[model samples]
Target: MAIEWKGIFPAFTTKFTAADELDLPLFGKNLQAQIAAGIDGVILGGSLGEASVITTAEKETLTKYAVEQVAGKIPVVMNIAEGATAEAIRQAKLAAAWGAKGLMLLPPMRYKSDERETAEYFKAVAASTELPIMIYNNPVDYKVEVTLAIFDQLQAYSNIQAVKESTRDVSNVTRMISRFGDRFSLLCGVDTLAMEEMILGANGWVGGLVCAFPAETVAIYKLTKAGRIAEALAIYRWFLPLLELDLHPKLVQYIKLAEQQAGLGSELVRAPRLALVGEERTRILKVIDSAIATRPVLPDYLSL
Candidate 1:
């Protein structure tokens, strides 16, 4: 399966059984919905998926399950978040073994590395895997910015094809296109800025809230790219509040809560990560519910 690496690729949240185990059946259900909703691709073990707490075995299981459920209807890209080069390489091979079509490779997990070290980390991982890679660059969350200079050095690797741009600075989108000139495919990684990024020529979207609203997400991407600004803005304006949830630190909790409200999956998270409760829970739910109450009717083109 050749991943275009363009359009809506949900950084899908992982589903857990009430006992906090991998809920394969339930997770598969969500993956199927993403495909049926016409998303471009699906990503597993991402930040929204609680990658920090999930073990290697669990990640492999998630990768294999996504491969099985998607069944080549779309690409299942595995996300590799590791603390060392060797570990990142190991996991990249593991994803290849599980039949993942692509990899979303992040910088060193905890320790922030300098430009040289970070470029080397990505290079080493690229050397180890045959799978096409999308470098995850979330400076706000990860604290290590894969600056344009670092990305320039990365241009040497052919398989290091795309970037998940989460610098949170929309101007960076223009800078990437101007400097790289399509040398690299740039996917907008921030949900709130998806519209602005796409308008600025982001090749695709590495989305967070798409876990709950796949159709709306795809509609926004398709509409924007089609030059349907009026139609896109209608949806983007309505979606802005929910999209803001992705910017929150507890984005997993907020997104999972939205998924549950949207009847997609359970909000059960792993230990050390508890479900939302009391005021926080109510606050998030109010936002989701208000969106549901006044959700806009989909454009006919989107229904296709």
Candidate 2:
């Protein structure tokens, strides 16, 4: 179950009930859709999955459930976004024990670690687990940035296999390729930048909106890889409005709302993140509804 680090890997949203409990049935349904749509892997407890609010036990539950659900049809990757290095390592070990095939590790959360500290944290975690890791290098959302120099230091860890490149500059894909070559697999982390990055040689996509629109997201990635640019661009153009929702602060609520609209999941976010309402709700629904209304007929992307 090693990670190939190529193709669509959704940063799946954790479904919650009205009482703020894990809605496994709904979560499983969406996961089934993602697998059915031909994703390369599934990441649990990511930013989109409300990782901060989810407790360790809950994350383990999610990892175990997803592992069982996918049943080795695909890799189940657990996201380790802990603030403490020891905690991150502990989670990595637990994820391995729970059957997670890979990890998506962010720089130490909350505290903005210096480059040296960041490299140490990553190295420490990498040494602790044999699991293949995808570094979440999202400087825009998270204050810390994993620059190429830091990656130069990290290249020693053979398990540090890929990067979730979210710098938003599509050119960074080429930059990573120029610097690292195939030393590290590069996956586009931003939904809006997926097509651009993919065209520039990104190995995969760690998508947020794919939680709601798995088939369309996978379509764009598959078509682009097949050298079907015109067909991919047509779908990407139609999908632009819905994809923009992932760049917002309240992405969890926004994406969960889209899931609800698509009959995929509920919009119940954890405390501190209330579900979208009033003008905001109306505005977002307009985007989601409009996209659904004009949803394009997909081609046989898998056959490509």
Please give the TM-score that candidate 1 achieves against the real structure.
0.98
Per residue, candidate 1 scores C-alpha lDDT tens digits across 186-300 of 9999998999999999988998888998888888888888899899999999999999999888999999999899989888888788999999999999999999888888786
Tens-place lDDT digits, model 2, residues 126-232: 99999999999989889998999999999999999999999988888998999989999999999899999999999889998898999999999999999999999
Superposition TM-score, candidate 2 onto the true structure: 0.99
Clashing pairs in 1: none
74: Cα error in model 2, Å: 0.5
Off by over 4 Å in 1: 302-304
Q: What 10-residue stretch in candidate 1 is worst by lDDT?
A: 295-304
RMSD of candidates 1 onward, in order: 1.1, 0.7
Error of 2 at 304 (Å): 1.5
Q: For candidate 1, what is the lDDT?
A: 0.89
